[model samples]
Target: MASKAGDDPDSLMSLCTIFCLKNLRRTMCYSEGEQNRLQLRPDVFLPGEICDRLVNEYMDLVHTDSDFEPQDGFFQLFSDPRSTRLTRLQLREDLVRDRDLEAIGKQDLMELHLTYCSRLTARGLRTLCSFRHSLLSLSLFGCSSVFFRKSGAPLAAGEDEDEEERLQRHTVDLDFSFQGFNRLRLLNLGGLRAELDVEKLLRPLPALTSLDLSSVHLPRPAFLTQWSERLASLVLYNVELTEELIHMLLQMSRLRHLDISRENQRTSKFKMTRKILSSIVQSLVDLVSLDISGHIMLDNCTVPAFEDAVGRPSIEPCKSSIYPFQELKRPLQFLGLYNTTLCNVTHIPAYKVLSFEPILRLLPQSSAPVSQHWATWALYNLVSVYCEYFTVKPSHQIRFHPKIMSFSV
Candidate 1:
């Protein structure tokens, strides 16, 4: 029995309800002249038809960006009769507060992302603990205000005295009561520099598989040891990879995605030699995404890997002193060498070589012009080299820059 086109869930979702502004640029809705004059108020409308479409069709209300910073504020946005069915919500760099979060708490949200919501404190976050059993993902990335005891938001002498007091109380609540996120699988605390007790934070999150501790202060590696068994994706970018951290990483047998990219200047040169690279390969058998970009390589000398892991032949780093090994079990899906040079990369393991998928993945969706520019160049080369067998994905079909196709021709 052939199902009708309307009966197909994929077809119906594509044809109706879900409205993604991601594919549609702001320029598509407003002219440059009108955009300049348009005051982007909280409750402002963007040409009646578009606004109507959003209200009528939205089922989940995923306004992921701060671009269309909800006309009626978050409260009114949730007040929509259709908003009762909402599950996932992502908001960034907004003046969203506890009162707004209270409204959001009413919904049975499964994935909540409140990135850089400076106005929000842990007091408001405690409201969403009711959804602890249901919620699977929560990213409070860059929302430093939640962790801090003080409000950085400039206020006159005696402005919102209650909220200031609340911030202090909630900061304490966050320390002990954050166990509500037990079912959470993905947690991103990137760029949050605060005095954090790493052990207490990870104690409740038993199900967490992907964690982004980028630019965070993870002094004790013992806290991360508990997560070694379940955690598959871990991003420790810009954090110091101490000797204990390296030893603990060697035990994470299930880890597939590891991003140890670091700042070139602040990070003392990490020695990434052939031996240490071999050790990583042998231990982390399931490792697929390895990002050791921007590090000081050794065995010879100078600048290297992940907040710069030191790999001196004379100095044994990890517990497994034995090296000159092979066997990945699987090829790495992505290898990030963003800031590394030929001089730095010497005796890296001869593991089947890298796939072009990483560069291909970067081209179409890259928000940065420089990334797109370099990715396009790399994509062309991959196409030229493997043009005989290369098959362009449908999503990547129209996104290729003109010069690459022209040059390839």
Candidate 2:
């Protein structure tokens, strides 16, 4: 017996509510933007009406997946108050059309995350300007084709034909504008390759405090002095670390967190020298966290002095030692040193007691020449740091170095 379209569960609104409640409840604990996968069956498409209905239902249920939970009290206690007012729409790896997003523009969306959405054109992205006033964060990670036109608005007739002609000839020179996001605070443009005019992009977004440009091949550093004072967190992962780039970054006086981990040896000249470290430490007085991992040249020559400045306990410097610099003014809380040539044991500086809690993560390099003595020293240092703040684990390889402290692996 063929069921009527009105009677079908897929078409009925009641079934939509039931299906959403069931699936969303399973993953209710995950944050709005945290769930990466949606188990939609392949070779089948949800009816357009159903899709629209689901989108609306999901937007409405942004506050809570279901009233009852295993830990109802705990869930309510930590629930976001703003979740009820603003919805977060995450559409990833989908063939989403312009109309699909245009419909979404009607709601007050706080966050819009679109990853690998190749079908969403430049025009589709521009359409989002309609709700720009309410939107707080927008992440378009790995959407390569969508771009910003240099001259954002369309050219008027009989006015600057030469400029239009040049633009037509060099369409590749186009870039995205940051006009819509007036209240945007966090933006992630990871894996986007374009020559972005930093000054122009940041001019409109004065409230923007956090930016992630990881794996995005940025053009030469320019106009960083403009918003350098406002940015609190920045990620320049795998970017070429030049002296000029460092100079540009140092201008950001209010930056509290920074990650400039150059994983690949893109160029031999890319070295984090003692001078550069000193400049960063001296300039960015508010820096609380930093990561300069994966740079081979970041050895004891620079790391020891930096550690000491930021409050690391007294540890012996390497054979090629550079030492006892001015103590760090800013209270650094976290330091990362994974896959670097720098010996973990050495260069742990003497931090001011009770001023701030510090955490140092050090994983030995695969290509490093490991010796018994070096391993023991590393182990000892790790134990000393661990015991200072945290309890030592029971299962361990304990060893006492004659010169250094006792450590366990």
Candidate 3:
């Protein structure tokens, strides 16, 4: 049967809501002994159901609250509140009622995303542990609900300084163990200010495959080594990267994607030098995607090491003996060098490093020139220098290297 264009998923979901309401009315009719007035409520697509008032409250919070600025109007598009025990619940700058928490404990929720819900206390977080066995994905990004202290506008000078001192003193001590999240696959603990003991938070979740610790206090590097083989994707944006941490990460050979992009423009004292880059390529052989771009301490010395790692032709020695590492174990898919010293296209050395050798490895064995390995290299800082490369476009290709490379604008 040819489905009409109007029978989209959104329409189908609406239809489901209607059917649930009808079912609820019919059930109410039978229970109330044919009462003229019938109350309608939604039914669960799976097993259990949620309160109608709670759904209305969530929708009202989304539309009226400024803090709950969803990425798009499509925030709650996929999961309808009317049905589905495993649903997406987003609450911001509002109190999580005890009844709601109780309801959540009863339902078989798979995903929960709570952001900036300042009124949700530590007790509420404890209550959330009820879903430890069921929840597959959980995000507590920007949620300062556990231990938030309110402050009034400064009436006197130096009051702001006093508040800062007070805030430091009252640092929330959030130490929830993740031992219960046995089935959790993806966890985002971004913007958490409390002390996160790696042993309790990370070691327990053996099934954890992806983690986002952006802007969160990092646990000891030694603790992360436990997940070296388990974790496939890790995001550490703006997290302080010490020399010890870099050395520890070298052992995570199973990591397929790693992002350590610095948020600040000023380079840190701990530079990501050639030695560090060489050690990374040598150690993290399974890495397919890596992002060490932005204002992290990147210098000229690191360029040659990257060129060698990605198999690009460089003025620097590319011989197996000089290079610390063998050919890259995993074909490099993405390289981010935006707003860094290595972004100079006018400079031959920078251009060579930016030439991206990973694309060459992905070239088809057949003689056909059309290639599928498209690599996106971000060079936002070097507009003039990048333009200069196009002037010598043909020079980029050679008879010796049949592999072709294409870059996204």
Question: Which is the winner by TM-score between candidate 1 and candidate 3?
Answer: 1
Candidate 1 — which residues are off by over 4 angstroms?
Answer: 1-69, 76-83, 149-176, 300-326, 342-409
Best by lDDT: 1
Instruction: In angstroms, give how far residue 275 of model 2 lies from its true place.
Output: 1.4
Off by over 4 Å in 2: 1-86, 148-176, 195-202, 266-268, 298-326, 346-409
User: Candidate 2: global Cα-lDDT?
Assistant: 0.54
Q: Report the Cα lDDT for candidate 3.
A: 0.53
Cα error, candidate 1, residue 28 (Å): 23
Tens-digit per-residue lDDT, 1-409, candidate 3: 6477356875665555444333543432123234433322233243333333234344554566666532221222223335434355655544433234544555556777766554454455666788888888888876644433323322121212333454443434345677688899888877776554544556788788888887766656677787788888888877788877787788777898888866445635556766777787777877766666554444444335444456543322233222322345533555444445543322121122233333335545674243111122332224235554745355544211222122322
Clashes of each: 15, 8, 0
RMSD (Cα, Å) of model 3: 11.7
Candidate 3 lDDT at 76 equals: 25
lDDT against the true structure, per candidate, is: 0.56, 0.54, 0.53
Regions of model 3 farther than 4 Å from truth: 1-7, 10-61, 64-84, 87-99, 147-175, 194-199, 301-327, 344-409
Instruction: Return the clash pairs for model 2, or none.
Output: 148-175, 148-176, 309-328, 311-351, 312-349, 312-350, 312-351, 313-349
lDDT tens string, model 2, 1-409? 5557558865666555646544653533232334443333223344434443454454345434555232212212112222223256666643444555654455566777777665555556666776688878888776643453324454222122333342343233244577768889888887765555444555678788888887765566656556686899998877777777888998999999888875444443587666676677788878777666556655344444554355333433232123312345533454444444432433332221111111112344664433322343355466567766875455644332223232223
- lDDT per residue for candidate 1 within 189-248, as digits (tens), equals 787755666556667787989998887887777778787889999988777777777888
